[model samples]
Target: MATVLLAVLVAGGVGCALVVCLLWRFHRALDRTPPDVGAFAHSAATRTAGAAAARTSSARMTNLTSALPWAVPLGTSVADSCRTEDRNPFLGPASWAPINCVRSTVFYLAFDGDIRTHLRQLDAVLAEQEWVGSGSSLNTLTGMATWLSQAGGDPSPAASQQGSTEPPGSRPICLSTTYGPATQKRAVPHGGLGLRLQVAVAELPCTPSAETGDLQTDGRPEKSPVEGTVYLTWHPLSTDTVSRSAYTAHRYVAALSLVDGYAVQSTSTTAPPSPLTR
Candidate 1:
């Protein structure tokens, strides 16, 4: 019994001593830092907060893209993949790829290019309600909408309906994508930003093709490919400069996946982090 008591005392004493030593070290480190340095760090955080406010700002739209007449995709994932790619085929400078496995109508998604570089840098926070999160919608839409209005041509509803809304070479919808089911498009205003350029794709007939060989090369799993008409639009109010260019929007087909609900977000860009993170 005495031996046990002695051991407990020793252990307790050692723990108390260790805690005291750690506290002392922390105190010393804080004391060693110059007062001016702390002031600068606080100042920096304050500035970052202001910048964060600018990124998540929101605006209401008078028109809704879904209200337009277009073919909407069915059974969720089995459709819309092509239209999603078609609407945002490239997203700035990234390349669009279909990752559908054979035997079932299922394809995963991927991208390639400089825009992919920017997307990697973006802090993507996904949710069923908002695809790219509220933080990104404001920063993405403002410029996209304005770009289409000023420089976009005909929206190139489809290959058959390719017409220049503006003079050729004067900067129309710059990406190599098509927007079928033309309608008056607008981004809905959510208190926290939502996918502004939302589209409703309809079912479209797709046949297995010869070039589908590379699609399954990745060896993901057994699944088929899907193609559908997506009814999405560009946010005329994005703050990002890249989204504002027709060239970029043309390449900006937001890579979407068929998970439950909606693909509710843009893969083209993401919202900045909170001031605290910065």
Candidate 2:
């Protein structure tokens, strides 16, 4: 009887150790995964809208929109629409004042030219807006350049810097979102596409409000998993560029979307920055 009891205790101890090991590995994986900032901020905004939400005034919206635009190339037609909302989950009651502002603007500009030429134009716009570049900035210029080269163009100047030299044209573009491993390749019209263009111009470095998390856009909302950012999505001219009418008809080539306003945290109390912000 004593021998059986001893054997049971030994087995139980081994089983407990194995269980602990499994739990440790599970926690380690969670640490490796990046936090979903937009989701967290959105949740916070929804929870705090009544008592601690920041508000955007009309004058602030005017000032913000005025400051947002970079010079559009002449002859590239421009159309834009703006909106302000109280309950729009995007216009938040989050910790960051700029994102919490109650308005968003979208600009659609169509350039009647080659995708390469327009890409350069977009590069200039990004530069003027102080968006980062590939080696340091992680924007579309380098990624697209790399993609173009993979699609039979000359090797991209930025290709040497990539960790993987193989073509990423057909790979999923957004790194922030979760998607099931895809079997089918994405269709490419004009050869293939590289990485999606993304750049952010942050405004109002003011004190954070009672809330502790500020969510910024990881890229454009439509193409990227990130939100609360100024995103630029560029569409290449159609393959049938030989027809002038068709080219002209493609009026919406590239789009820029952003949540607009200069709302900042207004609380007098200073709290330690949220760990998420770090």
Candidate 3:
């Protein structure tokens, strides 16, 4: 009986030692684990924040573009009004990296009238919107006309002129303006300084070929027989990509630090240090 009792006591002591050993090893493992930067970036909170920012910025830009006054002549029939939207994220002349802070939208409309008259009207409209004219440029009509022809409905005669020195050489005028924040305030969290508006007006002769006409039998309006075309684009003036990138990186690092700290705290508190480990 005494021998059996001694054996049971020995077994109990070994079991307790094994338990303590396991607890010590677990604590050590937790301390040795390193924080994963990638995991923090892919965390739910980070993803949600990114998605929300993109949606908010997109909606704000859409509203601004929708309010613009698109030029269309009265008592003159027109067709195939092509409008294009694009986002400009490049930082500088180098086009090194893309960022989410800068956004640009382009709109095209064709009308029949004097280019100066249309430009004056647009200028007046912009003035009412509190936009200050910054600068203007004059480029050959061929460049602007060719840009309009990409709409794909009909080919314009001006678009056909690649480098031909022809009569009636038209010089398209482009005006750049900066918008004041008196009326249209920038959206919060979008990192916008303000808005810049550009207006490019030119004269182009759009006449579709027989082949192109046959292709447009779907009763869809074709881009043709218009006296002139106008291109309008707007973008935020603030392009501080470095600051935005730094801010984003800081957020990820903070999140990771928080997560790692919490993990360590919870693991440390899981159990007291065993006397055997001590």
In order, candidate lDDTs are 0.26, 0.29, 0.30
Residues 13-92, model 3: lDDT tens digits: 99999988887666555433222322333445434443443343345334433453443311111111111111222221
Model 2: per-residue Cα lDDT at residue 111: 32
Candidate 2: count of backbone clashes, pairs at least 3 residues apart or interchain: 2
Write the residue-wise lDDT of candidate 1 on 35-144 in tens digits: 12112223443235433422322111111212211211111122111121332332222232221111011221112233323232321212212333234333333334
Each candidate structure's count of clashing pairs: 40, 2, 0
Clash list (residue pairs), candidate 2? 132-137, 133-137
Better of 1 and 2 by lDDT: 2
TM-score of each: 0.20, 0.28, 0.28
lDDT of 3: 0.30
Which candidate comes out best when scored by lDDT?
3
TM match of model 2 to true structure: 0.28
lDDT of 3 at 75: 15
> In model 1, where is the ten-residue run with the lowest total lDDT?
200-209
